[model samples]
Target: MAPDWPAALRVYLGVIAVGNLVWEAAHLPLYTLWNTGTAQEKLFAIVHCTGGDVLIALTCLALALITVGHRDWPLRAFRAVAAVTVVLGVGYTIFSEWLNIVVRQSWAYSELMPVVPIIDTGVTPLLQWLVVPLVALWLARRTVQRNLVVTASMNR
Candidate 1:
């Protein structure tokens, strides 16, 4: 049977939301200490981070689905998720770092933050794409698999 794309997408989004929240929470101190801004500014920063993370997660997921062919099985789907995360994570990190930091000067990284050797993006942001999305994708795949199992059992 064909997979339910809508249901899978919902699961993916939920996973991304939770994953992004955790990612932001983990790096909260870094951002707060680095910014030295007002409460409203901090709130905006949080919102911006969350929004951008979600966009990256969604784009990676879409690319993965396209590359590996989304399947009903969790394991199969995970291959795509993992592959795309690494590929896009590295690529986007480089491009975004160059664009935002080098070119536009939109944001500046603190000296405290560790930078990737060549790309110059912060370690946290790079890992944010690589690690967070994998976790989110895994959770989403598990959810979809569980639902499929439940539906199959119900039909039997």
Candidate 2:
């Protein structure tokens, strides 16, 4: 049997929240470690880490919570949340890369070479964009299926 669209959407939204929270939580240690390092370490860290990815991940979680609901509210809210997450994620990712480049230019590297920033800024937003539509479609399909089952049952 096909999955219900509303059900799928709920699951997907839950995923966005859980995934972002998990990713951010996982990075706390790394951020802490980086902060403890010297100034030289800081410069290197900024260049190497995609700080924007962290922000994007956080935004995803916030949007996910805002979008969750049992009825029409969830669907309506999904559109707004999805749009915000995509826009912010893209903007933040770009800003992160730009910051790394500027930091590298202004600061001098010690024994460690300046590393490239991780360009995974697009990952979270892209996944979110795909997820919303997929869930919507799944919900639609499920609704149709349920209607057909009900109709057949009534006829019999």
Candidate 3:
């Protein structure tokens, strides 16, 4: 039987929200804001970025679901769904980094931030996309499976 969709979505997004928040806080020192901005501003940046990260994760997952997943997802084609999600997230992150850092000058990195060659995106944000979503998806899948097991046993 199919997994509980609503519970899975909640787990997926909850992991993304918490993971991004912690990741943002951990990596803030690598940005210019760490040194230039006040403590409150830095805190706000972390929260704001975490919110954006959750939104982006949701969008990427939705796109991946439409393109590669089915109504029976997490029970089938999970790897494909995950791969598409990661690829979409990474691609968008690169573009967003270029736009915000180079074009808009909305933010800048410090000397400590490792940047990708030519494209000039931070390694941290790129890595964040790769790591956070995969972990979130994995946990969500686990949650769904456990819920399914419990549901099946109860039904029996």
Question: How many clashing residue pairs, candidate 2?
Answer: 2
The best candidate by lDDT is 3
lDDT of 3 by residue, 1-156 (tens): 877767778988999999999999999999999999999999999999999999999999999999999787776778999999999999999999889988999999999999888778899999999999999999888888999999899999
- On lDDT, who's better, 1 or 2? 1
TM-score of 3: 0.96
Question: lDDT of each model, Cα atoms only?
Answer: 0.71, 0.46, 0.92
Task: List residue ranges in candidate 3 displaced over 4 A.
Answer: none
For each candidate in turn, the TM-score is 0.82, 0.33, 0.96
Q: Candidate 1 versus the native: TM-score?
A: 0.82
Residue pairs with clashing backbones, model 3: none
**How well does candidate 2 score on lDDT at residue 26?**
39
* Each model's backbone clash number: 0, 2, 0
Q: What is the C-alpha lDDT profile of model 1 across 12-111, one tens digit per residue?
A: 6777777777777676555433467777776676678788878877787677777775565344666756776668866887798679888998767766
Better model by lDDT: candidate 1 vs candidate 3: 3
